[model samples]
Target chain A: MELELESEGGELVVPVELLYGITEELTVTVVLPFRDPFENGRLGSVGLRAKWRFATRFSPGRADAVAAVGGITVPRSSADGPQAGPVIIAGLAAGRESRRWYYFAGVRTAIHLADEGNDPGEQLLLNVAWGVRPWLTEYLAPDLVLLVEASSRTEGRTRVNGQTVDASGGEVLSVAPAFLLSYRNVMLKGGVQIPVWEHLNDAGRSEDVRILAALELHW
Target chain B: MNRTLFVLLAGFAFGVTPAAAQDAQRDSTEQVAPAAHPDIVMRVDGLACPFCAHGLERKLDALEATETVEIRLNEGLVLLYLRDEHSVSDQALTKAVTDAGFVVRAIERHPPTEGTD
Candidate 1:
């Protein structure tokens, strides 16, 4: 579940994801999003994602490792129907994991679809995160991971109703502090995204705070 | 003859005969042996998230002769216990880990345990 609060209104999102591992290097994911209740709640968007891990290295005796990751997201959310035009999202992620620490960096972009709201602008995203396990145990007690991340999303100019709208796109930077707990095969994660900076055009929308919480299960 | 008779009487009181005791010992001896159920332990990379760990577990469990799959997140260890008459190769283990989006660092074969039931 996710929620974003802005000057205009608030949005609530519930997303369901199904992922399968096809090969050692490839994975496929399907995502279906349920719309916000306050904003005419309905089926929002359906997305298909694929990721390939092309490189990896592990230490012989320790829990230290690194990997290179690449993936793409194909979105089907347009004004025409639920599964019409496609929006392309491509990104690269790299990360390292050790006994007590985790770090990651990623860059991605989203190409907007036609007739998707009033905005048809491209979005560029960059994110970096660092996480640490404060308490480590092998018992049934869940491991607690504290994470801090900084993310920036910048949007290009938009075309609304066939006319270019210069003021309809902007940039927002946010810092999120999150926590994850793993119990058995279930992981629970929650965080709040606080905007640190914003650069908006005259008519661009501004956001205040956004919150995210997700539950993952492994079969 | 008297000692043997007394021992047999004692065994009957305790719910065990000489032949039954030998069978029990043999059954236990077969448990921790490699011919029973073999266990494989692998040190894995990127067993960080529960999601990924779960995926690896599913893959390993799907393999033949797999009795149980256990993941030690803190240690980044994947343990697979195979039933009797089942075995997995090193390549299969590596492929399972990689398919689940992880890397295999090291693999070790441990003697089967007595408590796999």
Candidate 2:
């Protein structure tokens, strides 16, 4: 998936992670995250994941079946912005592999707690991934994947810093194009997330380009 | 008749040139020494997919055990080249990778290959 520790400008914004699933399928995941966007303070939270693996029942090869995952962000974190809580979300995902090609798709809706009395915290997100690992030889291989996702957001009228502005925001559309190139087990992942479209009352200064990079190793 | 003679001489020169070059290369290859580093093979669990593979490598980098790292995805194992083997042991290496979020299935001496020291 295309995730980022959202860093725009050079402000003290909480680093956002489009990151998830540090563990394998059908297992519980524990995420201890600290920080919130614009809070300038440490916000701590945890999560749990349960995969369904449904497609496993009918796969001809080593299919991962299907998965249903649900988790909640505790109220202790920021009660505002993208890291809203107490939030709950459930997702249904399915994946399959045919030789060199690996495919996956999932849809999720997060019910975040109310914010600014207008509910800018409630949203729904859907994402999909396709990857190809071409094995050139016994000691060399390359992995490539693409992801597409969209989210619906709610923004209430409010004032930031000190501007009495009527920020009647609604829904926003986002798209991310990601690429991962791997040499054997060591991989380099990079992606760019752009704001496609959104029903914003006033998307102050509009959004800017965001990016991320990470190195992964497999044994 | 002159063109044919020239062609024959050219063919003869080309054939002898490759043989002479091959003889010299073989002599140099035979004189080179083997590598000095040993192989570290580690079998691990919780490494069944791409996401974990990424995170596992990040975790392994945190250890700073040796310099170079080689991961075998299909074989579900990792190999490192350490200057001194004591810097990381079987159990210690397993715990580091696991703490970064992976399971250690096996740890053993990698069978030496022809050029390893």
Candidate 3:
């Protein structure tokens, strides 16, 4: 089990996750999120995700792998109100990693089910990342890595009681520079995401700079 | 206050004391000692990050025969020291590595040096 706290645009989300390895190539994770603890603290949706590494190529000190990812988020009521419905998520990820450098790309989609005459729409997310290790160190020593990621998000139109919400859907592209530091079983990761481009259907609040920091421990 | 905390954490993450450095050296020497050579050495692929590699260590440690596990990140090598009179099979080692989200590229077995048993 690992606990992670993520903050975006001044909102805090704490997610507790448990991972289970079912086979040599497959793993599953369960995540429960708690949002807005500093204000109207409440529980968010519970999610389950599965990843299967279907293809792999290995060399002496490098490897490349492609994984199929699928997941579902169960809607739950929060301090504000109940969510529209459950969300089904699916995606594919491919990455290559060596002793000094790493690269990754992934695409994911989430389809939100309608409930009580409300449809929350679908979302598509794409991400690409590059990483570098400044110094190569053995185990038990502190290690640091630097990474930069680019992402794009697009959403479909949302409906309420058969009416399309004009400002409900749009697209945003962002870039983030991050760092990962680790020693033994503990890790610290943090980043700031800055929106570079955006297009909305109607007038709405544009996305601002977002910050995140997380600490993880494996036992 | 938050900035100060971040600076402190960063310092801790990048700093290593002399004692810790010596311990790390000793640990590596123990694995390669003539009298105490590791029983198994595995070359693992896709081990890019130190933080993510902990899973591989945990999986290997779960084996009944495993006494100590040391990793060489640059070479993608994992050295296993086993308990007395205990043994781990190649299949088991491969499975452990795979379960930790890595592929085992090669495995080598080394017998204890003479008169060291």
Candidate 4:
């Protein structure tokens, strides 16, 4: 959900998640996605994330210290195609919750290496969840959330149609307003990406609209 | 006419008076069982947000360790009371927490019922 949908000139990648959550604050995320460039229908990656609690940790007496996270991403490489090695992310984050509102903010950077070269990307994401009505609480409540994301690239090489490409126009920023419906453990979430402003090679040509659905199972 | 009047009066009287109320028996406290245990109290390091905690809570419940799941944000701990002892091992519990992008700082065993026992 943190990944951007659009860039200045290229297509943004999307992943459909499964085995989404295998542990606490940790989720086993495997995604398979294929677009015009990948050609191969079965090209994707598997990754993991560790998120800390924002709501409960903020009360008078709660265990809400910020969180530390680390994970690896392995891509599915194919014959006669470039392979995207694993991507690693390490970062810190914190959050808080009110009667009907939840807020989260964090910063992180990814270390990715491919046959073309090694590229690192840094991003900061902020999320807000609001409960709109009691009627919305009936299994699925229609709610709204506001998101703000900012990213910059200091160094890295990118691939275009499986070839080494330029990492020009390195900085991009976006703000999005989203809506979600939560029914018990099942959450249905969707949103649109709007570019506030950014500097990039093809900066304004491509815009992204992303839809995400996730189910959280706990014991 | 006298017979009709008598019948109407009897029906009105019966409707006016409330039927004998069931005995107002007090509920016995013993009937309400106390919170059960052999419970697990797991403190996680990365549970820094609500959605993450909520998602883990759902996953754990799906696995059935859910008679009583207490998510205490203040202590950064999740206390689970199982219906039976065979719920899950400490390792499995730790794994569940860790996979959610969290670290299991500690896992403790708690007494079934509250008290000095």
Query: What is the model-wide C-alpha lDDT for candidate 1?
Result: 0.65
What would the per-residue lDDT of candidate 1 be over residues A1-219, giving only the tens digit for each residue? 111222213555666678775765576777767555345656556677777766666563223333344344444445124332356777888877655787888888887666444546788999999999887655234567899999999888777667787776788899999987765455667788899999877454676787776665544
What is the per-residue lDDT of model 2 for residues B21-59, given as tens digits with 9 covering 90 to 100?
A: 543354354235313543567776544444335455546
- Maximum-TM-score candidate: 3
What does candidate 4's lDDT look like per residue over A1-219, in tens digits? 222122213433444445543323344445444322333334446566555432323232223445666667776656214555677777666654332344555667777654345333333333333323222121112233344433333333465446555543255455555654433233344555555655555444333433332322222
Q: What tens digits encode model 4's per-residue C-alpha lDDT throughout B1-117?
A: 435533543442222212101100111321243264437787766443344465566456555554545565545778776665446667677666645545677777775333211
Each prediction's DockQ against the real complex: 0.13, 0.03, 0.42, 0.07
Tell me the tens digit of each residue's lDDT in model 1 across B1-117.
435533543444332544335434544644454333337888887666543455676688678767666677777777777776667778887777777767788888876333222
Better of 1 and 3 by TM-score: 3
Candidate 2: where is the Cα deviation over 4 Å?
A1-4, A8-25, A34-45, A57-64, A75-85, A114-121, A133-142, A146-169, A182-187, A203-205, A215-219, B1-117
Real interface contacts reproduced by model 2, as a fraction: 0.01
lDDT of 3 at B84: 79
Candidate whose lDDT is highest: 3
- Model 3: lDDT to the true structure: 0.79
Off by over 4 Å in 4: A1-40, A50-65, A79-84, A114-169, A202-219, B1-117
Query: When superposed on Cα atoms, how far off is each prediction in RMSD?
Result: 15.3, 16.3, 4.7, 16.7
TM-score of each: 0.70, 0.48, 0.83, 0.49
